[model samples]
Target: MERKTKLALAKTATLLAAIPALVYANASGPDPGLTGVPNEAGTCAACHGSGTSSINTKGGSVTVALPNGNSYVPGQAQHLVVTVADPTAKRWGFQLTARVAAGTSTQAGGFKSTDSNTQGICSNSQLRTAQPNTSGTCAASVPLMYVEHTTSGTRLGTTGSVTYGFDWTPPSTDAGKITLYVAANAANGNNQDDTGDHVYTATYSLTAATAAAQPTISAVVNGATFAAGIEAGSWVTIQGKNLTTAASCDAGSPRPGCRTWSSSDFTNGTPTSLDNVSVSIGGKAAFVYYISPTQINVQAPDINAGDVAVTVTNGNGTSNSVTVTAADFAPGFFQTGRYAIATHQDGSLVAPASVIPGASPAARGETVILWGTGFGPVSPSVVAGQTSSQAIGSALAYASAPPNITIGGVTATTVGAALNPSALGLYQIAVTVPNGAQSGDQPIIANSAGKTSPANVLFSVR
Candidate 1:
């Protein structure tokens, strides 16, 4: 009986192993077809069969169009369109791979599909444990990946040809040249695995691009994404076309005027403006911190409780006026999508996501300072763009209800809440992490009266 059971198990295993091949053979095309690896597609003739004439010359061809240009800028995303043309073809499919043109010819850049009909899979690398046994199967560890049409995508084809659109973000640094190896199939509408399909392969090349253009401003937003409206003494960011002409701000270049700001720059209650660019709120200059081609960091100038006009002027041109409301005690914290812009006592940044050595996470019980704009009022009210070298000599004008802050759902003590000494409109708040606070990333929020900040703000709690 044991021997009979073993034979039965072996027979069942054999049948299971044959299922993939059976599915591929019976289907109109190979199930889950391969894509993205250059010439390694292993000939479609394994299932589609070689036809009477050249598939490439059969009045059918595949063309790849890079929307930006034939050349590319490293780290830039380009929309790619692949179109197959055959007047008589009713169904269509395609596979594409990008690789270094020279050296080992390894894969380069990344591919993303925007269409629901197209699926992107690594060559033999992106495979299901149970994949169809067809040529270019993703069952093995193939170095390339492909983005091709799905069964539904193929079924959507009625006549002529079909086009697929996707996005490709290239590597940060140029990898000499990139070559895309593509294979496209024009199939008969009859829905059967036979000799009626034509397959064509082609190669396209792209080079690196040079310097582009300078910065431009689109909209100015509070540094804290969760908050609305810019307030006097609050951190605000101006975003628009071409904000950063080149690389984003870094330690070496720093953002223009960020590190050099001083109390005297805004002395006498004049608005602070950087030499590179100037922002005006209600006709008064605002304090400028960082400037990129497409974005500018600034402190909102002190303004009355009314609708205020704002504008940014750079070397290229002056932006159209954008009006915003001003109020007291509009508390907001500068934060990324996941974490607040916080710092340690030593002034080092708190960046839990950074892999850099000194970019450490905040620990429980530690005091960290968060920066943002729109902390309503302070005790010794100062004019917009005002600066002082000495620490604030008076108490802060706490909001009517004051702001309540919490970390990871635990109420944290606010140690300090005052205007930034170096720039107006930028407020600083120091909070101590509570003992019972959970570790890892913790959500943080500040509320004043009935106004609550945007949701999902976070900070790292080690």
Candidate 2:
């Protein structure tokens, strides 16, 4: 048995090493030149040979999906869904490039990798002309930007086909009409580099809208409590129209109504223009969370307490500035339904549903930590948009008195309340379960500086 195991390990290592470096890296396609549209050379047929080469226009196709009714706003950070379909194919690969329509193929706009499965490659015709044929080349006739499949993106055995999603930020200003050229390969799962594959080409056009309405700011409210007001370093939501292309989104996993965001999209501390949407409070950029056509969510940056100008910008256009006031403290707890964002001592969230192993049904005597936002300032202090991968060691800027916490009407002793180190404007409270706490779902309320949490949230106890 030991000898067999050793042999299996050796075989696996050898197989992995034998795979092409490009395949293992999962970066982009092997080469861009073979996409056929730019170089006019055959696609996968260049390597798999022409004898078995076949183009299946009917069986397989490539499509690009934009949110704005097929029209793109200048400098808008929008997600492009590239799909390649074939019912019988076991493996898939794709390469795509965008350039100005009619004129030279100079690369237009920009592409950013939203996930690890795809990467963006930018180059011009001059650069492609100098490179050796082995490295792959772009057309010298026009500059282009390519988005291609990585190793893991080469889905195997997926019944129909696969879709590659990434962010494409258009040019800051109008670039006239734009054209996209895509090449896709559908291959049999067999490991050999031979025939039994089909390659297809697709072209799409997008028109830049000059008359698009600028984003508007209807209301700005506390991110946690949804109250009409703002505070420094507090999460806030700006409600308006034409602010983004999509209507609704959640950053975590894509479950039903939620949209999955890549790990690289949301940074903790510093402000960013993800999706080409940004909110500036008192002239400072706030850390953006999610943006939809009607709403923009963000974390307010540090500022002095007073009326300030708040504006939302999409691409090169900025909305009319609105007046908003900031205060020293306006505590608001984050909630899902009526349950406060609390967790067990082990860091597993105390949710009504047991999503993680042994994470639900809070028991008496077990210490749990509650999470919130708009709890005021922190001792060590943090920037609005700076991202921290590790925990921060800082105390929360409390009201005149410490916060009062209760579970199911039973008073609980506070272990500690501090700013959650890893996230900005987030607060954490450690408390022990009360002896008389109810054994089912119960109300958990927290009060700080005279403001109380919403009564609709709940937490489970066992």
Candidate 3:
């Protein structure tokens, strides 16, 4: 019995050896550039449909699902899935490419395979090859890239439909618009030839997301009082939309909090722009200090008193010019809510202890320093956009005229009134609290150059 079995096996081996080996084309992967992209050969149908006009038959469909609807943010990555479906299909495969909508031959972004079921192809105008690395990046000379199925991705003889997933990163800058071209095959699983397969082609158009609206100025006001009007060398606050691009602290960005211009942001002079955000007042750039989406703090440039056009320019575009009255002196006191921002000689804050942690009310007869802006020009006038610098004892850059300051309706003795030497557009006033000053919140007002500080401001006194 053993000898008979050996003879049968030998006869079977001889019969197999006598037959020709069957070769299957595209069993590993299709050649490059078959995604039906513009200027490319017709989809897999060029090789899979037996030269018949039956390609793109009605029984099946190819679709691409994008995570971000029909718009893409520049430099953002999106996961995508390609699905090929046919009720009678027993195998599936697909290929896809993204091209700039303006010029279909130009690549729009990059595609990378997310799993073993897929692979990437890099192609030049004339030739194509497998991507050299997992990043799916192509050589600079070969700028076009495509993503398609690997051999195992075919799922031969096991499916009525199949889906492949990959990731696509949009260009770092807006590319206008983009289109994805995809071609898919739903095969019969015969493995003998490409005759009985269905070919499908689809294209998806995506637009660059509309950018944040250009900055819009709703109001231009004193940075200290939030009142309208501005003055040269004054701290001005621009109230607007889309003033800056930094995300707020609550927006989940990876910084400590909202962006504030730091010392490093200055160069030879104060930065006139921050994070590509700039302000032009009367056609002169303002020195930018703090920036946020809804507000910007800037030191107004030196300009004559008159109506001037104010505008903000940022990454998106320029805002509509808003006219604002510019004056030589628009005096304002920096305040914490209704309380004037004041400090004792030792630098401790003067406020209701409950208003600020570790704060105490100012004592009668004590000398308190008050902070403000827009006191107008001083002697040895400091250049706009430059830091204020003056020797403390040599000569003080005092206001053109000593400001008349009254607290609780009683005129206080003003000892010092000048621009703070260590800062720009900032002024400090030294005053002696009245001997008979009443306790609790006291109205504080400063009048300079005939302009009065906002009337509602007050300070805590005891």
Candidate 4:
């Protein structure tokens, strides 16, 4: 009985010793550096194929689905999936690596496991399980990083196909182009050996996304009327695409809490550029007031009347030159649709009460202040980019010639017309509502130096 028991124990130990060789053969993922990338040991076929069958000969395919189609943005994380499919296979496994396209042996980006189905390996001479360092990179000594399936990820007894998902973060800066190498195995699930398994390999190429576009100029027009003309010392609006790298707000403009140009943006005078965005009219730098991606407000430089070239320059590059008509006087009123912008003596807006939260129509024989732009030069010579000086006299920089003012086709007495003391390239005209003016919306017009304001402008009267 003792001899028989000893013989049974011996047989049991022998069987247990052989179990590991069969179950652990290539399980828990293969060794690193076997992705079939350049400088690596071929592919899974190096071990799975019995040296008789060619790779992918068993009618199976391996594929990788990239996150951003075929392009990758620098420093962006892309989720990737590798799939292995076969009609007869009941088990699957895969390994993948990313490398610079220019140097296939040089690692590109870093990988992280997004699920229990996958794990990361860092390889130099041998492979060791690793997580991306705090800087999202592998140690320099173990420069190569690989992602592959875990033991449970094999999905034994599964049919059709199996997939593994992971996340890869591209290099911090533009790496130009990158390539991903992948190898997969579709096993018949016999588990006896790797004899009946089929190996498949694939590669995917990715390119860096295109750079930001340069500035483009579409039109140059008067800031007030949006008409196609500019005058010396007048506010001009430039329409374009990519006019500035960022949106900028004027110090006292309506938009609040936005980035504005600091004193450093000026060059010994009024700022001609805001956040590296500048405009040029006839080769002279215009004072930049507001900047955005699609529009820019600037005070046109004192250029002679004729055709002038306009361009916008930003961090990306300079825009194409646009030709626009320039004149000494291109008069236009600041209006809301057809209504001329005006303020009552108490500073309330002169419009139908419904037009604004606090507005009332003008009464006949009442005085109102009108605002406009591009009304030609002012006396005592204020620079295009400089604010009008109050010391120039209490009148505050009167126009070279008083404009012809009419309300409802009856000539109204112009009390005063001058450049606004606090604003650049802005004009203020105070007039008395004519007693003969008809009630309701009345067409108001102003002409200076033979240039007429838009005739559609109206003023509300009661």
Candidate 5:
């Protein structure tokens, strides 16, 4: 079964089982019971082997597995098993055609075949009972059924009792239906009939257990993960924890109980921190030890990337951790794109400026492209005049000028200006060369900067 982490698609898992079986299934369902064979598969091999869907019950319960190779081959050596317990039956043993076909029932709960003439036998216990006693010569796969057989190495079960157990590679999905239809004789020898008043089928239930509950995550967290990281006026949803916001949890230290968030499980989102965390009925509250959010999606902080424990508030007390990362972030900035972005001294970064081809010192009413690292991301104010001495004669430095910008009051300043030219971070600004200023092929004074642009690259005003 797939565990649900709200939006999570994958999960981490761990579980163990004792019986492994290979059941034969034809279009008609479980094939007829096989009996009296000297092999690791016991008597079940006659039906489970070769071209049949019936799996041998000799090796305990054999798991019908699907491997990396989609197709199964002939004579392939495999580990498998099967198990049955009748507390009141004469004794315990692996499933045999005798048992399956006989529709044998325990006196009360025992599997002892009154026919085996054996008495006081125990039920199957995984990995404990290693050996099973049989009255015939069989295949190598046959002996494996009595894994607890004293000869195998360790007898994990009671004396004279047989159980199913073997190493298994397991399967991708443990949530499907498997059927057992082979028959066993109640009296053991030469019985082809499934004769017994109690002859019937049993259903094995499937479960998604404890081992598959833990979550796997990957993400970036910082104070930013907790809300605007002190920049916003207030409030931010610290996202993480396939997480929730309200629940019986703790916060770190003096602020113990209910609010501690770990740096390792946090992330930033549209509004930073989340609100209206569900305290009940499908709330956004997540694990506090992980400081995950039920209100928002969070990723597991990488141990290699220097993730720290900011505040782990679980049902227990709050705690802090200094280190958690196993390594660090994978190499490269502008990781997938064409730009070669690097850190600069001003703390401001940008993409290559958008350069305007022409239009400076125009006669009147004309557009000029003002190119530079920081250009009009949105509509911006502009000023034009004769080139001032500060200008480089041939160029104008397009800048953020006077007032800073804001997006409908949302402050869209998360990104900084990258002054790389190859990336062209500049833009275009236009204005008249200014009615009566100095002419003579002089550089135009782009905006209010008193900078002198180059003379040769100058435009003429009528």
Candidate 6:
């Protein structure tokens, strides 16, 4: 078993070594290239000139004079175009095909691609005998050397060249071959039929690879989250296993590699454009970017109302989803004398908390306690209707103020305004029964920000 394994390994290595480095310009055809009779003489010059050749092919013939070449690169969208001549049939035409080898055709075996070709077209034929009138375009999938586009004089012309070649990313080997055939038909001006086996051979080999790999996409993360109210031009951080990775893409590709976290990548991948409020971060390998993934930092991007979601794709077979909300995120509630209001974690007043106890309008003294969180400092305030004229202490005095205060509907007069240090978490503003003030589940408003304790001051004036 060990000996057999060694032999197999040896065979594989030998096979790979036989493969050439490149293929493109190393075509096995005419020396310099046999596009027409004038090009044929150039083949002989290779032996004379620096790197020239005199291999040429015209009507009814196909020629290749190179000694070595390499495989065709695939993603590069590489391809070839050739013209052949079929001099036989009363009406003559030609067929074209391709053959690919792993090595210099001498060492490793070759494989024939069976894909459709777009380069196969008739150059000269009986059907095209009217000088430049060629019919039918012959296309095939490449990586293979086989005869096709066998046009009859009735459907084609003679005396011209049949063009064929390849289109694909050539493999990383050299032993590749592209062969062509010329066939004539009865309609050909020659007035005779050409056999099926008529063909011309041109073989060349190249060494090592002159190309590189195709753009391969990769991501480090799989998804991200977005806050509501998409702010245009914000770089929404996206995480995925390959989000930061860069794909080289094809050389012939119109789109070059995208910036690591470009919006184009996400928009192009998905039919719809990325939400204006979001975008991906850029990098390579385990890519990284800043976008809210989980609990938002208190100092980080502000939270908004409504839910938002994001989808991140690595473009290499993986993706995931992220969710967000529009509701303001708060750590605690606000104080309004047991009647509280909703505020965001940033401590800004939000939804007003409904007054409870459901009592009818009151006209005298009453007390109210505000409840919630983050009441760092107590601020002075006044109701919409009453001004300094409704005096009752530092809380609210009408300068011997006659009007009092209203505590959640029950009117009252300020007994005293309790002022505590900013650090104090709670306070008790007390008031006495008073007249002239009326209310129905009305609120005891404040004039300052961040004040929550000692809800309302009440007083009385008989």
TM-scores, all models, native as reference = 0.44, 0.48, 0.56, 0.54, 0.22, 0.27
By TM-score, the candidates rank as 3, 4, 2, 1, 6, 5
Model 6 agreement with the true structure over 1-462: per-residue lDDT tens digits: 999999999999987675442111111211212211221222222221122222222234453222123444322334444344455422222223232333211112222223332222222211221111122222222112222322221233433444444443333354344322222111233322122223343443333343442222222221111212121111122433333124333334333222223445333332121111122222111112222222111111222334444434332222344453322211122333333332233433322223333222222443332222221222343221122223223442211111233445545554443322231122223444344444333344332232222333221111
Off by over 4 Å in 6: 1-81, 85-155, 158-162, 165-462
Q: Per-residue alpha-carbon lDDT of model 1 for 7-121, expressed as tens digits? A: 9999999998987767443233333333334334343444553742455766778899986666888887788899988867787777776777884246667667776656665
Tell how far residue 105 is off in model 6, in angstroms.
5.5
State model 5's lDDT.
0.25
Off by over 4 Å in 5: 1-91, 95-163, 166-177, 180-214, 223-462
Question: Model 2 misses residue 292 by how many Å?
Answer: 2.4
lDDT of 6 at 370: 27
After the best TM-score superposition of candidate 5, give how far the Cα of residue 81 lies from its true spot, in angstroms.
9.6
Taking all chains together, the TM-score of candidate 6 against the true structure is 0.27
lDDT of 4 by residue, 41-126 (tens): 77888778664256777788999998688888787788999989988888888899989999877888988888888888777744
lDDT of 2 by residue, 1-462 (tens): 999999999999998886766354322364655555554444655654233246654377767777765567788778888888876778878877667776634566767767766776645554352121212233445345677887778877765878898877777788888877777777676645555666667777889975567778888888876775567888888887877645456665443212323466645534467666777898888877766767667888888888989998876479989998887666767876666777876777787565445558778998888887766655545555542223233444433345788888888888777766566677777889898998988888777776566666687898
Prediction 3 global C-alpha lDDT: 0.82
**What lDDT score is found at residue 398 in candidate 5?**
33
Q: C-alpha displacement of 85 in model 3, angstroms?
A: 42
| Leading candidate by TM-score | 3
Q: Which structure is stronger by lDDT: 3 or 6?
A: 3
lDDT of 4 at 189: 78
Q: Between candidates 5 and 6, which one is better according to TM-score?
A: 6
Higher-ranked by TM-score: 1 or 6 = 1
